[model samples]
Target: MYTDSATYNALLDGFCKCGQIDEAFMLFKSFRDDGFKVGIRGFSCMIDGLIRSKRIGEAEKLFQKVFDVGLVPDLILYSIMIRGLSESRRLEDATNMFRDMIGKGIVPDTQCYNMLIKGFCDVGLLDEARSLKLEISQHDQFPNTCTYTILICGLCRNGLLGEAQQIFNDMEKLGCSPSAVTFNALIDGLCKDGKLEEAHLMLYKMEIGKNPSLFLRLSQSADPILDSASLQKMVENFVDSGLILKAYKLLMQLADSGVVPNINTYNTLINGMCRAGQVNRALRLSEELQLKGHFPDSVTYSTLIEGLQRVDREGDAYKLFEQMTENGCKPNSSVYKTLLSWSCRRRKTTVAFGIWLKYLRSLAGHDGEALKLTEEFFQKGDMEKALRSLLEMESKLADFDSAPYSIWLVGLCQADRVEEALKTFSILEEFNVVVSAPGCVKLIHALCSGGKLDKAVDIFLYTMEKGYRLMPRVCNSVLQVLLDSKDNTILAFELLDKMKSMGYDLNSYLHRRTKSLLQHHYSLRKMENVAAR
Candidate 1:
């Protein structure tokens, strides 16, 4: 019953316009099977569909098929193909297509010229696009609202807001009112440029103008490429500037406007409230986001846990931690680390060990638990228990390393346990991780404090041989230790000279005091010699 080529072409065009490219192709194959030839319009329709769906490669292949079919495409087909190529940002190809059409004596209409001009402008070829526009106007043909909209959007996207505004004014002078598509594009551009006040003013104008048409325009335009992103930046500025009510009003507006708030938007608002120490407000926002179909993800819970822990709200933090897990969110290793760090800071050794055991048992029975517990004990200043914890778990944790072992060694050296400290050092060397600079410096200071200068010298020499850079604080602590011993006073100055050569600026007062003490001791010896004479 479908006997005409134009009828089938119309049907194919309808399919392609509705995004049914595959179905359109199927009908084309049926036409070929029935010995009915296809025209350039049907083929161009399929190409348009491919381009709309971002299948540029397939569109190109179909473009070549049109030529292979031995039918010269008309201006309509060329326009559709140019629109596809331009929208895909194939500016050069779109230009070539236009030139090819012109060479074939097919003069471009408004649609063809607009498509290529927009392509050139979108890619920042403003001069070329302007030249094309001027040529079209010289021919007594005027550009449409869509043509001005494209140029304005291109200018705005390229951050030429001033130029974009001029074009916008020109559009208004031409009595061409901006559609919702045009307004949305400008709003997005303004928001990205941080022109929030302007965006707000535009939104206000749209609302008060009773233009339900604009709302429909925005809703029906291509799904927004901007939503909730500007909400985050606005919330941050409002919080920093103490505009809490403004932030709250913006959030409500976004909700009413059907803009989906992203995770970053929720986090920004919640964390800003917490940073302001408005914990109650922060907690309420967390509940609000969750109730609005966005569950607090890992980052959200972690931020709340950290904020509560920082303010000594451990009971509240623990309750939230448990609730997070009950809500089907698994607590990560970072959560356990935060709790352990909090316990250590509060000097709750028992609580720290309990958390460590819980973390280990959760992963069955692993020796990592022992290493973590030993570090906790050392951090809480329980060296004996720390060393004991490591030793008891040594066989199971054979491959484990603990900072507590080095911490215990320093404690032993402070207790005058020379042989025990040496044994600890030997155990450390066997583990293949050399003593850290802080560990070595702590051990040297402990030895010097206990009047064991020889052992301290040996440890310092060993540290140098290992190539560890001594911190200025550690160097100062060591020199103070030597000053107490009153034996290595000369060596301390030699160390100071070395530190200076290594670019460390020792305190002028401390250096002068050390020199004065040395001079006084030399004068005492001279006085003793003179008295004997």
Candidate 2:
């Protein structure tokens, strides 16, 4: 089964793949000495291995050797050479090789197009990548599903989620089905953009849209029919597993086809409707659920409560709250937290505090204890304790942004934990968190007071870069610190000029003092120069 040439080629390729170039060349020389015609496969293998090893120069030279000798390379060789160049980020070389393929009358295929497009995308040349898509269309080759998936993923990675979605829609319209990887790109993009709710919806779609029952799942296959019992069992399984979104979609489809949904299916639909902020739809579904003998449970009431709160229907929320209690459904901490948060959002701090107080003793040694402890510690100036309590809260709620991280920043400053304070501020900035200017200023002042002027300057410059202007009073205090603690008078004077440019009008006394201090500094410098002379 193995000719000597075939065996030698395989061995050479294995050496190249493993980056053993010297042995591969020795084998190549052995082939040449044995009078075998130069193998294109051996050349392609070496090119790829060199590229993978980041030795693009050597690959390029080998490519030139093949090209210069007018060796008629096959499609695999051409594709391999182009891929190596693309992966090496040598875009121009890849382009030339692409052209060379055409000039050599070798017809390029979809993989070649994909490689070039992916190369452009990797280098942030999206317009070029799109232009190639149009070029491919001009060649009368419509993009396949992989092409669309590649473009969609590339656009999303570049923060062009809208464009990615447009392409995704185009893919669907063109009869190109989306794979899990394609959907995940958009989900990941939404998460990166901090659109957590949108991300959740996409996840809902991925889960429920794709995980249909047997008949529905097989609708695209050769046999698309199932018995009534099988369909009912499928719906029941979806409902049992809490796949509410899928169950709701399937139930609605079933309704259109004259099959009324069961109670469990209706409840699932109602819950999904509430979560999607279609509270009115949920209400209608609730009425229909009861008509179907599906009594609303505690989950239904809780979902409705949240839905009502989301829509700012506080009066209706309370009415439902009373209704749930009268029906003997005990209110849980989640329900109370939702109520307290809504009340607090409405500026009813007193009512919110009342709600918290009412629940405090009931939730002893539970999650609610952290919120209570944070409140108590903050009010009592026990910032360290407050910060720890907040960390505990964050451990449970991934999207927790109850208070500005600036609160802990101020506490860290007051505790003279300068390094910790700066690190915390950096974390807040990295997340694009809106910190209070007063708290940042407090940190700066604390640093200045501690005579860590260099660190203070770092924070000041960082804040200025973030568009937070330094207060005139703070500037004056920093200037005082600079004059007293640091010997860099030129930097002090530069700061004075910056203050003037920023329109921070100094008081008359501080004005005279700064001018007088600068004059004295200059005179002292001049005297030192004369003494050296």
Candidate 3:
């Protein structure tokens, strides 16, 4: 093979294109050593290969050598140098090189402009990136899909979601169809911002391939642009945001679009529906999912069972638990805990005991240690020791859930250990355990009965602050205790006003009693004033 300068340049170009940078570099060095004058074309190939290999310093030296060799760099060489510098995060150097390219009468194309914009965006210089995007149009070059997508992605990453959305809308108006990457970035931003409805609508548009105008009307619009998305994640966001109905509707749309949701998605919807007090709707959804061949997993069963129990449908919950076992979906520790906690709260002693037995049977030997300590402490009437042992076992075994701690708090309150119960409640709170509403109410009432009026008021206020719904009787009892005390009448009135702000209605008896007490207090004050006069 009689290799000449042209043949050497061809080999270099081929090696660089194929990512054989070392081979390309060695061939270039050998060609130079053989006294073959390397043309600007050969230098461009070598520089591009060095840049691709992340050897920016070496590439810059080669680029400088082109000027020393008295060869004015062409647009191809300048473009390669600018792209290399921009990608290496040397934005200033890239910008200077870009200006130099123009100074030498070499006009840049849209691709060159896009490279600079991406560099700006990569470093969160969104304002600069946006400016470069505008510059593209001024240079008689329209911003392409790549350009807009880069800017949108950068804006979204910087939490400028509103601007990102506007850019997306503009991209659509200009007839640039958004790619999957663009949609994913925008959807993810919306989800993170808690804009569940917007995220859902955007995801629907992406999956269904509807045009902007038609999507606004949600009718038959543009051609279908089918793209894959994190549909389950969007459902989760909807559920987490308390948009249960919206999540349900999203699920329906997903199904209509021939996108099959997994059982996890159904389970999330069921949990959200149950929490929103739409237990009946949740059950219907369960049936719908089952019909669609998405059988309920243990999570689905546990969520529905808890939802049923929440609505006071204990029999339905029990039946579902049996169905879960029959379906071969072994109820997990969570399911057993749910049954045990609810049974104990409802004072179904036999049911709770049975559930506890089943829970123990379901666990391996060591996993049941904390529960056994709970049982032993309860049997010996040692609530403190029981709680202590449970905590110790939890630190060692890490198998105890919030259920056993809640049961102990309720039991302590029921046993009239109000002080101990309060301390236990505080410990539970420190551990981020949510005590049941019934347990809170019982503790509050017990505190009132024990002549701990201030403590009782504090507990009541704490529960109210946490958004726990208590019976009117609890409020009335606290108000009665406050009004009965000479020093706490003002507190009673303040509590009444606070309750009003919280949307609680005072019963007629308390209202009348408050009025009578105020009048009586005024009458006594008037008698004292007369005596002083």
TM-score for each prediction? 0.41, 0.39, 0.40
Q: Candidate 3 has what TM-score?
A: 0.40
lDDT of 2 by residue, 164-239 (tens): 9888777767898887778898899989989999889888877776544644654544533244444455555665
- Cα deviation at 260, candidate 1, in Å, is 2.1
Sort the predicted structures by TM-score, highest score first. 1, 3, 2
In order, candidate lDDTs are 0.70, 0.69, 0.77
Candidate 3, 331-369: lDDT as tens digits: 987788778767756655445555665565566755466
lDDT of 2 at 29: 67
- Give the local distance difference test score of model 2: 0.69
lDDT of 2 at 450: 74
- Could you say which candidate leads in TM-score? 1
> Which candidate, 1 or 2, has the higher TM-score?
1
Question: Model 1: how far is 123 from its true place, Å?
Answer: 66
RMSD of 3: 29.4
Best by lDDT: 3
The residue pairs in collision within model 3 are 209-225
Candidate 2, TM-score vs. the true structure?
A: 0.39
Task: Give the Cα-based TM-score of candidate 1 against the true structure.
Answer: 0.41
**Segments in model 2 whose C-alpha atoms lie over 4 Å from true places:** 68-70, 208-533
Which 10 residues in a row give candidate 1 its minimum summed lDDT? 506-515
Give the least accurate 10-residue stretch of model 3, judged by summed lDDT: 219-228
